[model samples]
Target: MLYKVLEVPGIEYIVLDFKSSDGNFIAQDLDDSETWNAKAFYQWLIDEVLVFTDDGISGMDKDLYKQFKAFANQRGVCVCDSRKI
Candidate 1:
């Protein structure tokens, strides 16, 4: 059997290690929960994910930076500045 994968055009796949204070290496996400609306960010992801469903955002593994890259690529489809930010 052959397995096929899809990705957004011109979307560069990125893989890199990032760190968070208080030692998230054991558990927890890289996002800064302090002084940031985790709920809003989560909701933003949900909202954007729905819009980018036709692109290449669905079924992508939500592990570490992989999901964000896909999300970024999907977001890249609609918004330019947010991808940079």
Candidate 2:
């Protein structure tokens, strides 16, 4: 797993790249190119990038996503899937 923090003038976001024998998982904001905070970034990462199925399944690794959620929570960011509600 490799990650990078992108910081610009007024925007900041983290890009997480996880590689495994199955495939590569890259977490980022896919809908929009701009991000402002960890909350929004993680929210979008889960909602848009992960794109959970109706059965609550995503292509990403479950453990990795769990770690991402924990990291976001530590930073006061809610990475809950809005579409599930």
Give me the candidate number with maximum TM-score. 2
CA error at residue 33 for candidate 1, angstroms: 17
**lDDT for 5 (candidate 1):** 19
What C-alpha lDDT does candidate 2 achieve relative to the native structure?
Answer: 0.50
| lDDT accuracy of residue 68 in candidate 1 | 50
Q: Local distance difference test, per candidate?
A: 0.33, 0.50
Per-residue alpha-carbon lDDT of model 2 for 1-85, expressed as tens digits? 1242122111244554445343334455445654335455555555555555553335545666566667767656676666766
lDDT of 1 by residue, 1-85 (tens): 0011123222223222225463222212235322323233334444533223444344543352355544445434322223334
Superposition error at 53 for model 1 (Å)? 6.1
RMSD of each: 12.0, 10.5
Candidate 2 residue pairs that clash: none
Deviating ranges (above 4 Å) for candidate 1: 1-36, 50-59, 62-85
What TM-score goes with each of the models? Answer: 0.23, 0.47
Point to the candidate with the largest lDDT. Answer: 2
Give the clash total for candidate 1.
Answer: 0
